[model samples]
Target: MTSTSGARSHTSPWELYDGLTALVPRGVTVTTCVVSRWALVETDAGGAGLSSVPDDGRDDPHGPQDVVGQDLADVAALVRSWDRRLAAIGLASINAWCNTQERLEAHAGDVIDWDASAFERSGELVQGRRVAVVGRFRHLDQLASRCDLTVLERRPQGRDLPDAAAEFVLPEVDHAFITSMTLANKTLPRLLELSGGARTTLVGPSTPLAPEAFAGRVDEISGSLVYDAPWCRRALMQGQGMASMRGALTLFNLRVPA
Candidate 1:
């Protein structure tokens, strides 16, 4: 959730990126080259045409051309030509949003409860600890509340990292729970970096549980065990996105030994 849209028409990717890039934040900038590559492939396979018009499209006085309805492969080729630029822009926008604090306080008091589908099966491991949640989505709140939690409504800033919510302020708190959606915005590594020294845990369906991939990154994993999804398989084939997909509730403990 990047909320760049206002009361007007839909916000273009450039507009959203421009609005976010104004702020600077201290977090690892995760480049979404893979997503860009996939998007290019999708466009190619789907046959969306490429446009020669500027991003805003208003600058082209001759007006925009009908790049749509072209061959899918041609569309994919055009996307490949512009993939780097698109990825750069997307990363910058993510950096901007990561630094903003505007949305951090929006749902501060929302209560989180457990959903039988995801966490109950793991038993009562989260019975009496304060938890801080990241990411924005309707169903996520349910999971957080079950853990007796508070929402970390931190919005991504253009430059500065969003403030971790009140629950994270408790130095004695037992755990910090993050979501797989963080991967969508390229903030998973940054979130790990922020929770580096704390008693935190990564809970999502997208985490890779291999000791080699997560040895120094996380402590324990708890979520869906997704080892057989088509996109995931493809990502593995392409040397990326190989994490399992256990129905979107994979949980990984982030404990490190002293």
Candidate 2:
């Protein structure tokens, strides 16, 4: 008989939020928060974090769009308490902000500067397996040449499959590369559910490095850390993307312990 256990194998954003919030100690105050091309948060403790700013401001279900004036600690605490569908992007940024501080204080030793490319690490794992990529990446051309690959984009472009294909194609693949923006869009849980037996990985600049948040559901978490918050903020405020801003970021990866 197939053994049925406790909650199904998936990482709920709320679960991640709970795990993340537990690490945040009291008395830490938010020093600054800016939402431009990128959402940025800096705590009084000199820790900073960045994320893709949420769009659809008009459709945000959480009260108003004026989160600019709220308390950082209060906003961070409320992030875990809200329904995932409400003001999702904003919540994602807030979570990233809180997680940055928490990781700086607690997991400082675990955060290391990565010299290798994330695509190389991903390519090594999918050697002979079919691959399903959830978001478009510039390095995809390298991977496509080696294996059968399907790329699903929210806005289908060129050869990319539409988002609907995720449910149909993900289960059949041997490995998957899912974007960390899924958390901002409130699709991470569902994507993880669709991942099935694939060695699934969450990849992007927006991903949080909170291992406890990912736990068993994710095989790897590849994301960025703010190396120079002031520079990043200035570029973001000037409408430049992450790539346009140099020396402001560092890439990092966390493999889930087996």
Candidate 3:
């Protein structure tokens, strides 16, 4: 693990938004959570929306709720309205308890740029190509099924970063995806550095627009454009340890300048 010197501090949505407002980037949106709903902040552009998730009709500990699912339609609408230059959208739903990796793999042919079916179902190799993925969870084996793909896990603690940084020694790759939760641990910059020379993408809401931190480092960032609810955060905070929040937020994605 790599070590940084700083005390962990709790952040409110307002504070997080304020910090991001100071360094907005072109063609990017920052999404954070409100109460039971989500909010979108297009720093470079100007638009906002909400998301929907599947409902189990179960009462939430926080209170009664209408379980709206991920608004993929609305997301696509935003991209279209943005003139299609929106390269990618960052989502942080992983923290919201969404299992997006499986969703992505299930819809690989439709969602991913390449033929993810071979990778997901057969674990077949996409020959002569290299790929990078940050944030390790249950989907690693499926991702590793692609013989040509090299998976690098990024886990940043408050003080120490993951040892996976050394894997960046590989020459380069075709694509890269990062998780926004890296913001909570402040390891996005380091992960971007590791993706050097690759057509990199950051895939988490925690991604910040401090371009200088990733300039000459990565090529793109992708994640959810919104954050999770305060209730979700409170639930995680009230957990026995960090496990609950970790479990909830793993379902989404986001992106930033890498």
Q: Assess every candidate by TM-score.
A: 0.37, 0.80, 0.39
Candidate 1 least-lDDT 10 residues: 46-55
**Model 2 spans > 4 angstroms off:** 1-13, 54-71, 77-113
| Candidate 2 per-residue C-alpha lDDT over 11-64 given as tens digits, one digit per residue, 9 for 90 to 100 | 345776666556555565666666665667676666676666444333335443
**Each model's lDDT:** 0.34, 0.64, 0.35
Write candidate 3's Cα lDDT for 1-258 as tens digits: 111211112233233323333332233433433223222222212222222221122223454222133333233222211111111222222222222243335433333332121124323333345665555434555555554555444444442235365364333555555554443333445554555545555543344323333333444333332233343446533533223333333222222222
What TM value does model 3 have?
A: 0.39
Reference-based lDDT, residue 151, model 2: 97
lDDT of 1 by residue, 2-97 (tens): 111111222232332233333323332222222322221112111110111111111224422233343322222222123333332233223223
Model 3 clashes, total count: 55
The residue-level lDDT of candidate 2 at 185 comes to 61
| Candidate 2 structure, TM-score to reference | 0.80
Q: State in Å the error of residue 141, model 3.
A: 3.1
Candidates 1 and 3: which is better by TM-score?
3
Residue 43: error of model 2 in Å? 1.0
The numbered model that scores best in TM-score is 2
